[model samples]
Target: MKRLLAAFLAVTLAVSAPIAAMAGSASLILDARTGKVLASENGDVLNHPASLTKMMTLYLTFEALNRGKITWDTPIVMSKYAASRPPTKLGVKAGGTITVREAVYGMIVKSANDAAAAVGETLAGSESNFARVMTQKARQLGMNRTAFYNASGLPDERQVTTARDMSTLGVALLKHYPREYRLFSMTAFTFRGKTIRGHNNLMVRYQGMDGIKTGYTNASGFNLVSAVRDGNRRVVGVVLGGRTARSRDAQMAALLDKYLGRASSGGRLLASVGAKQPVEVASAAADTDAPLAAAAPRSEGEAGNAPFALGYSDTATVPLERPAALEEMANAGKPQPSIRGWQIQISAAPSADAARALLAQAKSEGGTALKSATPYTEAFGTGANAIYRARFVGFDSEQAATAACEALKKRSYDCVLLANQG
Candidate 1:
């Protein structure tokens, strides 16, 4: 299991505790460059993901685009099931059609439930099957704690995720699909001569914050996953269970301010008293690693280089064609994990500092299960080109170590078990 001491240290030294209005909230901040966990609070606790579920729905749509299975111009017809969804929808009538490109903006800007279901049905033939596919994709991305019951993320006890999982998904979106990820920054979109505004204000309100998703439901409260880029560094932050949109936005803004700077304590633990690994944490760790890339600082109100911008036009602009290589990036050069006993291995980093940041992030994501595991930085290759791998010692049996990996994966941390080769 990994521990989250650095996050606690950064928060304690840099900011005050949350106000009463934000009680029982959960949040996480991650370094997009190195996949570091900067700060977290109740990040692993289960909560409904609400409209944030659209992020995954869009992810699969992007996957389709990359695979050439669906083009941006392909039309998706609305079924009654899709059109009947509640408010915050595109209001397409049953049998009406919208292009894949329109569905993408509808989901991002309007958080339209109808557009989500239509896209899902177009891809998987049914909403339920599409959800199953979503869950499968989540697991492949290491989102063990998350499950999708519907494309719309409508109220369902079974549709749940953690702040950690959402942050990981946010990182994956940018890392795996840079071209499609640009849609999140759109502040508004025009549909049938009417302009629909987006609910996520972070893009306009926060300087560095660019694009991501926001969610709200009575049971889920207000939730948001924000992606911010500063110079060569990028950070993804998640807030779940906010009392209101205002409080949630404030909580996330404060976290971004305090943890995104130089205050991070890389090796600190959240609590002095450590707990032993529990049985549940050992079984479930598997996921594709996120890419390491330096992002240029974003200009105010500008995210990606995509030509699409907010405001209604009588004619919608055609989406830019993504490079053919975009799809293969998801599975290219993926290193195989150790399969024998059960030690957890996160991604390799090009530098010691990055390895340490990843190590801190892993510990925070793993929590109690990894508290007892010793941290080790193993170097691979040599000289200036050497990459360091961050690893945690394993339990005596594969079952325990495997359990621990599973526990971390559910929270969307990169963890793969290795057999003890003694």
Candidate 2:
């Protein structure tokens, strides 16, 4: 009996060891300008990509746009299969349409699985074909160990990537499409009268960090690709197989902090690829401008109603409740309260009312983060060019203000911590 049991236990260990190895943590950091690997740990080990697969999906979309195969306004009609994708989706009905621009935002900010499927179909006639194209592009880009089976990066045993491959993709996006790359920095966007927010909270709060992507799934664990530009230095970092979203972000942040100072400066990644550095442009609309009509409600799932935070299951949406003091102040229509220590600005609007509207939206999404902070707006410029800065005040210290802004970013609200001049 002892001999038989020993043989059975050995067989069980052999079967499970490979599965455990596939889910282990991996990381990589690279200097974008010099194409130098600054740090790596199991960087080439294959692991499920989860939604980080959208990075390649967006890469192909940008390529098509650059090649004139599609335009930003091109309509992407949702098919039955696309619309039927599980939660964390845009919820467009079958035969319904969204512009290429909208689809891009849906994938980046909302991480909508349906949007990804529609874009894939539009580009390649089907998601499977798109996956083939994606893998081909991966080889061309030098990602030898990666394979993609779907565009949305949903659960697929056959789809896998590596930390080093993700960093390579991040650098490619920065180098080849400098203009469209700016979209990755967006924390939230107005979609059909509602704000579709993103889950990359670390990018919003991490100074110098711009855009990239995040992913999560039961099998893949938490994954992130981050790019940062500080002064003349630029670096791309990837972390995979984290136990939680917070831990994943923390790991990425630590990697950047450790290697950014060591990164070589004086050369731009886009310039090295002979790509023109496009001039940055600001949005022309005010915050209060009415958004387009919303699409159908998302399919039933806990993540559908929650802030789009990639793969975490605990980040459910909570109703906003204003503190009594804030309510009283709003009721009185009082002038900006004099009490202040530190402040945070969310955005600027064309009018005071517009600014106030922005403040309300921020508070609603910010939840308990901004509960103790006072809400107000301050005007700048003059005449038709005048703008009102939407702000929150009353934090007693810079640490307090920074903490609140970090929380707001986690909820997908743009935030900038500031010192109160008063």
| Top lDDT model | 2
lDDT tens digits, residue span 34-88, model 1: 6668898998888889999999999888876774556788777777778888978
lDDT of each: 0.64, 0.68
Name the top TM-score candidate.
2
- What TM-score do all the candidates reach, one by one? 0.59, 0.60
Candidate 2 per-residue lDDT over residues 190-247, each given as its tens digit = 8888888898999988999998999988989999999999999999999999999999
lDDT at position 43, candidate 1 = 81
TM-score of model 2 (CA atoms)? 0.60
Whole-model lDDT for model 1 versus the true structure?
A: 0.64
Model 1's C-alpha root-mean-square deviation from the true structure amounts to 17.1
